[model samples]
Target: MQKIVPNIWFDGTAAEAAEHYARVLPDTSGRVLMRYPEEGLPDFQKALAGQPLTAEIVVGESAEDGGCRIVLINAGPEFAPNESISFMLNFDPSRDPDAAATLEAVWAGLGDGGEVLAELDEYPFSPRYGWIRDRYGVTWQLILTHPDGEPRPFVIPSLLFCGAAQNRAKAAIAAYTSLFDDSGVGMIVDYSTATGAVRADSVMFGDFRLAGQWFTAVDSPEPRDFSFTCGVSLQVNCADQAEIDRCWEALSAVPEAEQCGWCADEFGLSWQIVPEEMGSLMASPEAYGAMLAMKKIVIADFPK
Candidate 1:
């Protein structure tokens, strides 16, 4: 299983979104998990009964596994996807003969009910590139990869620290790298000119490794109406309770935001410090009930 996975929250469209991606993207698949009402928990059960609560999806292929696994949840409309976090899709012609065609197909599929943030065109960064927000409000940055540059994963999560968090990208990257084993900071390019609210010399673009996964981050100077929310989060699956506690101690900043193993870091990015055995324990209604009542997960509550 992936140690760290991206979790996407949607307003009851998680299953539909997952199905769309499974059909549109090559080498991808999705499975939905429903939440049925349980006895003795009237309010909680009533709120989630018969809901297609979660969707697990795999996209692209990885050397360690088939692809990246993401969790999607129908968690209501309290939060919505924004540019604060987006996925970057890299299509390398050298790796796939049908790269260009695949890119066009994906662009059209995603653009069906989406709005283009950056039109596809040649830029100094790549020959073909575009940024778009899909119907579900999830943003994606698609680029025809340069054959000469270092190879990267098929899909990578990108963090844009905008608004009040502007210029704090480096700090967040540092914190994450330090928290995860086998992690390190990579190339970082600073902004050359002040753009809107962002200052020059702040991170323009950078890459970092956390738990052996590469993720990009940038300090966007552009003003935005939204900041980081629970709409998107990074779930870190720990080997044991010790690992979970350590991560929770290091990453959690807003005490009030901590709930059911979920927390918000100092940079406002959300994270879930979950135990590796959570999947198996969650199968039991009693364990699930215990999970709902706790702020942080307790392994002892679930029987081995």
Candidate 2:
């Protein structure tokens, strides 16, 4: 089961963005998971009435297929997705014979009205790879993987620790691994000394697993204008209230960032920790109203 899911906030129409991804990426499809309430919405969200509140896009048919799920949020243009958090798509030749061709197709599709940060060409590390930001301002890194490397999922959420959060990749990964079960650090490659723009003792590339999901973290030697923000958040679905409480206590570092079950960690990354019953609980108008006023979700307070 997927315990942690990546949530992306889009300034444009989320449903359209989901569909765009489905059309571009292979073995992917988009569906509207939840719609905004037709009535009793706040003024800011009034325009989104009867529209998709949350849209989901699954990379593969199932988790057993080594795929992942992503949630696209429907909200105002308050937040913008940046390179600070991006999804890494791996096309392993061992798993698929046409990995190179498929990667090219994905790269071209994502390049539609997208800005290429790294050209799609051979690099020292990979024969074919590229980093780009799509039309919706969401970034993705597509890479053709070597068959001999350790097996991993098709999709991996990556973090670029730059700006104010530079050189904290190790600490951030440690904090997350300690909070979640079945989590541990995988491979970590750090810079030994400062090299021009590169910083000393910074993580060049590090990957870890949290709740069975693969994620990579990179400590940017060079600073950028962006860092972690609410635009890209990780949503954790808990089995019960106890799990939610435990996760909240361990991850919530900013008191002011807590709102409606959402909290920002010390690394400035946003997270939504909620019970699996969240959808059912928020079904009632009363419960929905109560959630708007909550800091940490209390399942007991929800209407039964």
Candidate 3:
């Protein structure tokens, strides 16, 4: 029942990726809604088009679809996953009379500096959108007209991981499920082919529920760029500083850790241990001075 769900990536081009993607989709708003982990927000990286671990972008759905709902993550290179994960969009069939046409237009825009996989085609499953690794080597599948058109704007039901790192998929799935409550592996199909005949779908692909969102992961032989950093960060709304520190300490425990709340976990995935009320606090005049004082902060900075 998540209205606007995005299975994002943190390739070096988070801002560029968001800007590029925003151009193709209908909404087309000014770039940048929010950037996080004050110290982690890089100056040279942004100029170099480096990946971002924390970002919020507005794509698809202009005024009709209801504001910029989709978000991207540039959480840094440590957290970059191959095409095994992607974002899926569910267009409103009843309202979008020319869904195919609109979808194709979007494809063309995003495809400007990117590659196309299946082109814009009506598949047996649904009117689908497919694109292989973009210029940044990120894969995406944009689907239109949900099977039931049930006002489900978007869903990350599962993620598809491809490339030489199939085994890594299992490790990532297991690690993530352990961190969040109500998380467990759903369906898994592993290595079922004609006696070791490695078809594209030979590896394992399954579903998992993390936090409250549903996602899928798979392993394929596709090569991926190690360009993903901490640009696209998962925005967790914490109840208090206790919750923030609990998740932060648990996730960011690797050497690749950076300031401004970005860190690589033991699993190589990047995360931001940001406060839930940080956004509201920063928007205030008083907090702005404190924000400028330090790149990263704890609860004491914004005491109750």
Q: Going through the candidates in order, what is the number of backbone clashes in each?
A: 0, 0, 38
Q: Tens digit of lDDT per residue, candidate 3, span 1-304?
A: 2221343565456677666665666665434545544443346444433224445555544444344344565545655544444555555567577777776776666566777766667676575756545665556666777646434434353344433333466777888888777788777776555233234344455667777556666555444544223433344556677776777776766644655555666544445556656667765445534554443356577523
Estimate, for each residue in 1-304, the C-alpha lDDT of model 2 and write its tens digit: 5799899998758999999989998888998888888888888888888888899899975546556889999888999899999999999999789999999999999999999999999998899999999999999999998899998888999999987787799999999999888999999998989864456777899999998788999988776777999999999999998999999998899999999999999999999999887889988867767888899989998887
Comparison by TM-score, 2 against 3, better one: 2
Best by TM-score: 2
The C-alpha RMSD of each candidate to the native structure, in angstroms, is 1.7, 1.3, 6.2
Model 3 Cα displacement at 228 (Å)? 5.4
Ranking by TM-score: 2, 1, 3
Model 1: per-residue lDDT, tens digit, 1-304? Answer: 6789999999878999999888877778988965643543546346666677688789985434467888898767778878999999989888877877888899998998999999988899998999999999999999999888887788889999987677899888888898888899889998878878677878988999888888999988677766788989999999998998899999899999998899999999999989987778777767656777778788887755
Better candidate by TM-score, 1 or 2: 2
Clashes of 3: 38
| Angstrom error at residue 119, model 3 | 4.5
TM-score, one value per model: 0.95, 0.97, 0.63
**Candidate 2 lDDT for residue 178:** 91
